[model samples]
Target: MTTNLTQHFLLDPEVVFLNHGSFGACPRPVFEDYQRWQLKLERQPVEFLDSRRGLAANLRVARTALAAELGTDADSLAQVTNATTGLNIALQSLPLKPGDEILTTNHEYSALEKTLLFIARRTGAKIVTVEIALPLNSAEAFHDAVLAGFTDRTRLLFLSHITSPTALLFPIERLVAEARQRGIWSVIDGAHTPGHIPLDLDALGADFYSGNCHKWLMSPKGSAFLHVRPEWQAMIDPLVISHGWTADNKEPGVRGPFGASAFVDEVEMQGTRDPSPWLAVPSALAFRRDHDWWQVAAECSRLAQETAARVRDLFGLPALSAPSLSAPQMVAMPIPPCDPIAVHDALLRDYGIEIPVFEWQGHHIARLSCQGYNTREQMDLLVKALGELLGLEQPRRKLGQA
Candidate 1:
């Protein structure tokens, strides 16, 4: 923590950026590499963007690096703009009929909730949402809550690896396995999980998983990957029809013009787009390796937990979960009754802290994110700012107290 890791990032020095869980801050080296890729593309547009030329081969190299980090085969992964797009591709492709059920939970990201609603309206499929109880203490509690939602009509199960609103980590391994046993397809939204936690997608056994490198991996924005098991890859259709897509895509082992499986080629080869962020992924991985980011992330998790506890005591608020059940580097603390927008604006205006304040399940939440660049002093600053803004002149009840 004494090494001043902030110097390596491109964030503004004036802002105490506690919003890494939102669009992440790219490190200097990775941003430079992203610019380098952009320069290369501009130098020769035809050679860089043409699938028959350097484009396809270059994309494969990036995918290989990401696949190794994700513990999946390169061919099973496809580069997309973000996890939302990836999940859209996976969800819309499913052959949902009238009366089929798409099972999910209450804590899913709002954008995805809209996506699910759209799909349900169009396909006449019903969305069965289960409520995950708060103050989570054990994995069994999560498993029990989710497993009870499954029914014979359930065809697809969608879940967030780390929830957005409450910032709690759902123990999805058991639920995914149970879904598989029930012959239900499992799709995971891993937007906050790529570098925040250790992942082994093949071992996880989810039918489809999508994550954002731009969030936790510290890559440039608009970089993410979707992984599909080989058996299910043929069923995935690209969001856009492009040259790489073929009508005979249902035939297995069919390689596109890029020499990768039809699944990867179709999802990745959309119309002209900047591939710089995707190509810069290897540099982001390298940066993490060189910095020993695992150790830094551990420190960050400790800081996040300690800070959340302090905030909880300040507001007399109960915890959403135990430390083990929460996100490693992001903690959403329940704040005293207040307008979320006013608190959010006051923090930025009165203090230079950048954080997210919103309502979840009728409770106002102040979500804090800790990255390698954050310091103990910054966390203290945030606590001081909140106390003053909310008029918490005296500490309230302790975290576990009723």
Candidate 2:
């Protein structure tokens, strides 16, 4: 935390970036590693792609690093382009009968919700949505909302590990356990989870989970992974059928260090494309270790908590979650009722700050992400800009002036 780590990243110096959750900003060294891999591929397309050894080794190394960091078996996980791609693959492979219900919370990422809808349309599956009340205080509040939507027809539970809109980390471990007791499949969207918080995919025990390395792990874009529990791996197919379709499905130890399961081989054996982003995950893990990540995470957490409290008070809006239940590095704080699009544009153009402003479930909110590169000065600038746009005095300065 002592180092001014902004020098390592490749962000626009003129703009204050507060939206790390959307698309992560990669560091110079990691970006260089990515470019190096891409250039190597271009130089000898046949040598890189045809040999299969290099790509296979890179995939093993990346998955090994991720497995160590995320607490799951390496073979059970396979790299994908992004979380959305992974979700589509999983949803498509499911055996949904007519009128079977796929239950999910309202706070999920919109695109994935649309994916579920696509699946519903293709099959005769029905979608059941649970409305979780805001100003949630504990894990019990989350548990209640989810169970309220369950019925005899509920066959699968799709929920976010960390929701995109509300930014609250759901208490999924117990829910997954309860679903297992009743023979239900749990599909989790964990796009925001990798480096935002500690991950233990095995312990969570969801039947399916998809997470993005590009968002929080500081990897290149187009890097993510889908993890299927061993029981479900055989049934899940590749999004695109390539050479792997003919490959042996039950061969044990066919691949290298991480090796090929029918799952890993089928999903990863697609034809030629740039694999630099997935390959660069090892470098991203190394970068995280070289810097003191614990301290960096702590600093970001403190800043996030302070920003959330101040913003919520400014608008007289309630906290969407308890501090521990909310993410340490990101918070979806409610702003006073105003045109969020206007405020968003003015902040970027007039104040040179980059962040996200969106409407979620009929409320306008701003989600802020504090990274190692950010400082209190940048936060103060954001607070000032928001105050002027909202036509109010500085919220932090006028704490007790009621």
Candidate 3:
């Protein structure tokens, strides 16, 4: 509740950052840790660059810590720059044939949607976007709608664990199980799941999953990961071809002198890049633990519920997801009829509130994310601003109104 604790972030103090779900704000301590790694790299470029051992070792440490947090083995997981890159790798690596179908929800992120479209066009595969109703009434309804999208010809099911535009957490556990039963591959875009919800990759049971640490985990930007089941590993080809493609007659699994297998040699050695963000993941984890993020999340959930109630009361709109179905930490509320862009811009320019507003299936949503730093006063300001701007109470003076 105190600005003292919140001031450690480099976020603009004048703005109320309600959009942590988009890209997370890194803490000062974590930022310092990231810089330390950068400094270390600069101090010994020859020792670090000439030897793959140092980079691999650091990666192994990061992988172990991340795997423990995600409840998966380190061997099946590797760090990537972000979830988008991971999704691209997954889509491009999959062996799709003509007439195959990739079923997804209409609520998917636009970037990943474009990637799927590109794959469909190149491989003659079909991308079927099933409409999942907004102002969702119950968990059963959501599950039924998603399951209805499956078909005999469906080769893959691509879905967002937490949808970007909608900001609703999909019931992926049941879907993953059903997809497995149908012998269909499940590739989940978990970009928003890692820090917001509990994730056990082994227990979640997906063929491929990718998440961004930069968003919720409070890691520096460009920190993300990709997890692939061992069976599908053979089919994956790195997007880049470098030392990983063909090393000079080296034994398998061994980090060959300089260059290696396409998986490790190419992707791992993208060449003279900043590994600071990835290396600072452990520090981010420590920061979360030190701050008691679990309790912080619980508090945020309470605040989110309160904020949602207030917004719904002001607008007379329905809730997007059932209280039990959605993560308590984040809420996507239905906004009364308005231009999403206009409302979004008004909130920022007039009220100094930062949030995401978008139209989903004929309903406009003002998705509000509650992080530890946010206070009830900020939510109240948002409500007041929204009421005045939308003429919910009375016709307030417009921007240019006399």
Candidate 4:
């Protein structure tokens, strides 16, 4: 049964929102928590803003909770604005030289690709993008495609935990292990992984991993975390430098407390900013516990699987990934020979459904995401709308006219 609590989100009431995989929807309770922190900061700028120690303490609490969730030490995890920012910290901090190659898959997010290109231009390094064939059938095929990218010049392996456009979950564990065995650095872009799927960073064994708390954890925007292994901590220099660099009381050249230096020292103090989103992470976790989000996930997964199956039956296209390999909460269904943009626009303008549709190397995919708020009636409506838009009812219409 769907809970009434799911109705508290701020998404448009008229539209069927299936794009929670993009920017997440925050519940009323978590939003209130975020506002409270903002109010506290506003009440006393001097006490809250001036005191680095106080802000750091609050940040410490949030980081501790996030670290516990990801299965890593608190010191190794730093609270960033989002997964992309954390990813930038890892990619930019790398001490790459000319001729070094950062290997990645062709299914990477466009923003991250631009970041890699920027790094390549600056350091004279090469970006190696290996293609993983679509309708990805097995883990062995993915592993082989990634391993084939490894070469003597390969210095780093950057891959997504869950690809953005394709909406397929990659088998990162095998790739991480292979990179470690070959003495190459592994950086995982886990923007969509944390809340959508189970995460055990320590067991996953990636050298650097970054994820968004806002997406799956139901936190407010700007809530994200970056996890770094102890050995690779020294390589990262924070994107911002403030009082963390030098002080009258502290010793010179001292990093902050988290890593070799403080995690906040390198990253946290980015001039005047709001820390409310980061501070409200714990409250988001509390909301999940209070509402039993695990059960919600299971229900959502069932709906996603059922919707995907119906779409597949209607289209007669092959399933992208097996049930066992992919999470039931999200599914990518192949669209038949049609203009992806045209079909996507028609769905939105005609049906009033909000879902993601895109092309991946000559194949069109209509990716649907099911959350607790979604209803079976909504899925039925979507199926009917898609069928009508795809001309699947052409014969029936002709018979009726006759």
> Model 3, range 155-228, lDDT digits (tens) per residue?
99999998887778788899899999999999999999998887999999899999999988999999998888
Q: Tell me the tens digit of each residue's lDDT in model 4 across 1-402.
A: 365355678778888888788888898889999999999899987778754538777877888888887787777887889999999999999999999999999889999999999999999999999998877889899899889989999999999988888778888898899899999999999998887887999998899899999988889999898888877776777787765543322222345642224544667766788989989999988888888888888888888888888989998988888765565577877777666776777677777788888887787888888887888888898888777867556633422333
| Candidate number with greatest lDDT | 1
* Local distance difference test values of all predictions, in order: 0.91, 0.85, 0.81, 0.82
| Sort order, lDDT high to low | 1, 2, 4, 3
Candidate 3: segments with Cα more than 4 A from true spot: 1-4, 246-266, 393-402
Tens-digit lDDT string for candidate 2 (87-188): 888889999999899999888899998999999999999999998888778899889889888899999999999989988988888999988888999999
TM-score per candidate, chains pooled = 0.96, 0.94, 0.92, 0.92
Each candidate's clash count: 0, 0, 6, 5
Q: What's the residue-level lDDT of 307 in candidate 1?
A: 95
Distance from true location, Cα of 231 in model 1, Å? 0.5
Ranking by TM-score: 1, 2, 3, 4
* Off by more than 4 A, model 1: 249-252, 392-402
Q: What's the true lDDT of residue 68 in model 2?
A: 88
Residue-level error in angstroms, candidate 2, position 327: 1.5
The TM-score that candidate 1 achieves is 0.96
- Ten residues in sequence with the least summed lDDT for candidate 1: 393-402
Q: List the pairs of residues colliding in candidate 3.
A: 243-260, 244-260, 244-261, 244-262, 244-265, 244-266
Best candidate, TM-score-wise? Answer: 1
